[model samples]
Target: MWPEVKIVHGKPTHSQSQGSVERAHRDIEEMLGAWMDENKTKDWPAGIKFIQFKKNRALHSGIGRSPYEAMFGCPARVGQASAGIPHDLMNHLATEEDIENLLKEMEGESNDLEDPNSHGEREDEENTVPETVDAVRTESNEDVVCGQCYTVLPLGEEVNNDGKCFNCERQGNIVNERKRSRESLEKQATKMLKLSKKKFSEVQVGTTVRVPIPDVDRARGSPRNVLAVVGSVEDGLYKLCMCS
Candidate 1:
């Protein structure tokens, strides 16, 4: 189906020949395991689809862009899948617009509360509660308000010692986790590259080299009997042509 593709077979058990494919397989396995554990399901076939969706949208460290964006030449557009869910069950599924409007409303109420000119206005309206105040009062009876954002959390939901709701706490944790993961990955990659540099030198085109024979082919040839000539080099990868 893909006419533009050129297939080159790699030697069996030679991961260096297909490092990208090996890495992708490792990532997919990790994601699939996490998905299955989160959903409490053993059916990995169903989880693979979700894993693929997430992987394509995730940013690739080497490419510096998501695979979906690289292939489509645009960023992937994601929709709110929880839009049809009931608000009580999925209260945390607030959209960007909803959050923005809530922030604006809170800022306006804060200004109203602080203004000395509004003292007479508040006294005049003492019999009638403001909409924001009424909303807070209504939610406080059934939910807990976050100390940081004043967002109402569902009853029985966990809150941090500092009174931050689950959503706020999760967001903070995710940011910190991502920062630590990125730093660790960068350090590991740098160390690996430094070690590889000391072990291997650059190969030039037309240079004859002895490549290791795969285990499956070892019966027919020596371990390092395969001879090849480097044809070209691009992006630190060498294209080699097998010699008879």
Candidate 2:
């Protein structure tokens, strides 16, 4: 009899299948944490872009090159210092007028960086999404409007639980619009997890579990522990059946 060959697919929760992605996530978290500690600030979103830039330019042991260099034929181009224009060539080729123009451009950039109004404008642009949503909500007509873009809900079109119209809900614009910075959310989540921490044995299929009686049931002199057996597990959720 010939041996049978079968291919077994990995489960979605299988860590082995996502080792590299998990490692990358760990590296990002460590770098972001260090950055936050150094800055004495919890604003991770501000530092994440800089971390991403650094990560791309960093040499990778596996790839034998920086990710930026691997993607492009050359190393990542950064500030004016590494602009790749040869100093000798510039001195020989650039006219006095060209040099003056370059100095004027650099001065303009420096002035823009120093300008408080310019910085405020950049911050305003970053924070405008919530303001836009609020403005849209206030200006919307009495007719059913999408929670996201404030577009009128057409007849026969469904609105989600949050009152977002079909198109807006499908595109997840409402969720995206309401999203806080990842670092802020992650910090909040960590605090919540710490506050809610409890010790419990690992649950599995066929494991016996005890559920607490509701307040109303307890008032009626019901037992605190209601015994149940886990029937199945899916996506960290356990299906349980009360013992007869």
Candidate 3:
């Protein structure tokens, strides 16, 4: 019983795992040019661009330092995280308790109304009717904020912490429901504004693009010949200009 079968063992010319490698190589070759601006700059080594192309094809790095690196052990730069969270997200990360107190003080308050700086004396309800109490309650009810929708929902749709609204319909996760006040919503509104401002801040310094104007703007009903500088607000929601 020396040898039962002919043992064939020699250096293989090509790798047995070559199929996947060839397919991957083809795909990478196709994607190897014009995808590398600042956005793809982290994949600089394999990024390719022609003189005609302002940008180059980018490569995915999944092992060096970015999420790609951590997940795949590849050497690629991490994509930007701040892109999803609005630019001013840091300022609005308040606790639930703080939001609740702020809403009570702003209930039924008109947009132009001033904040009550001093605690005024309580009003006497000696002659107050049930209807008046109902109205007051109705007005105050407008202050609650829906964590899902973020903004304070309509009065009739205001949801409690259980995530059930006044109409008894649930808008989101009951467990994730929040008890934010109008004041908190207002603060969020300001942060939204700042976030929007930061979005416009990306317009290159002293550079401009033909952006659409809002009908409610200075050149309402007419095309606005305005600067594209910071805060030169454009209404991306509409097609205002003639060429827009």
Candidate 4:
């Protein structure tokens, strides 16, 4: 006789998932409160993105890394400048020489920018679809003129085959762009982290630096900002002293 397999549960009311979730909820609440106090805004929904960014970039004690790094296998860019960008990405996107060339090229063009919100606004009156241009996508790489202004699109992916570019098509395209941006940022952060480690070895005993004080609050551009000089180096650690 084949006995029916009985399902055994751990406990009547046992759930370990609540632990992480509760901790995350508490952290998010604290962050949201701080942000609201700082900005004087009650827009919780809008502030969620800002909170998520901080949480993702922040280092986690349990994981010994940031959440972004754990998920992407790369360091997260919290708020660093071009010092954090990797050489590969910098070269791939735009090098310093490329920027110089672009500046030189722009020198000949008019100073008037494409600013729509300027004092003297240049409004586009032709908002309606034109009759001559075909809005729908006909082929894989066919050139389609914009129905609104009759301007030829740079690429075929600019508009969908249904002649609707305002909603899903544009939103999906933006999402793809954002994803690529995140990947680039991750690579940059990882490379910069490595470079920063190497830079620590180059620091001499007399090198002066601005040492960040933990749990200290000060106004912007305050005189109380702490400056320290490296006194000694031991086991890859810098012993710093307050600068006179």
Better of 1 and 2 by lDDT: 1
lDDT tens digits by residue: candidate 1, 1-244: 9999986554657457598889889988999999999999999999887788898889876555666655555556665432333345346646787655655776898899999999999887875657656776587655678988898775457578999987777667656545555666787789889999889999889999888756665664446567899999989999999845
lDDT of 1: 0.74
Residue range 123-204, candidate 4, lDDT tens digits: 3323333322344444333665555455565543365575645454444555554565567667777887799888765788
Q: How should the candidates be ordered by lDDT, best one leading?
A: 1, 2, 4, 3
lDDT top scorer? 1
lDDT of 2 by residue, 5-57 (tens): 76544333424659779889999999999999999998899998999999999
Report the Cα RMSD per candidate. Answer: 14.7, 23.1, 28.1, 22.2
Distance from true location, Cα of 63 in model 1, Å: 19
What is residue 56's positional error in candidate 1, in angstroms? 23
Which pairs, if any, clash in model 2?
Answer: none
Worst 10 residues of 3 by lDDT: 51-60
Between candidates 2 and 3, which one is better according to TM-score?
Answer: 2
Steric collisions counted per model: 0, 0, 17, 0
Residue 197 Cα positional deviation in candidate 3, in Å, after optimal superposition: 61
lDDT for 125 (candidate 4): 26
Question: Model 4: runs farther than 4 Å from truth?
Answer: 1-16, 80-244
TM-score rank order: 1, 2, 4, 3
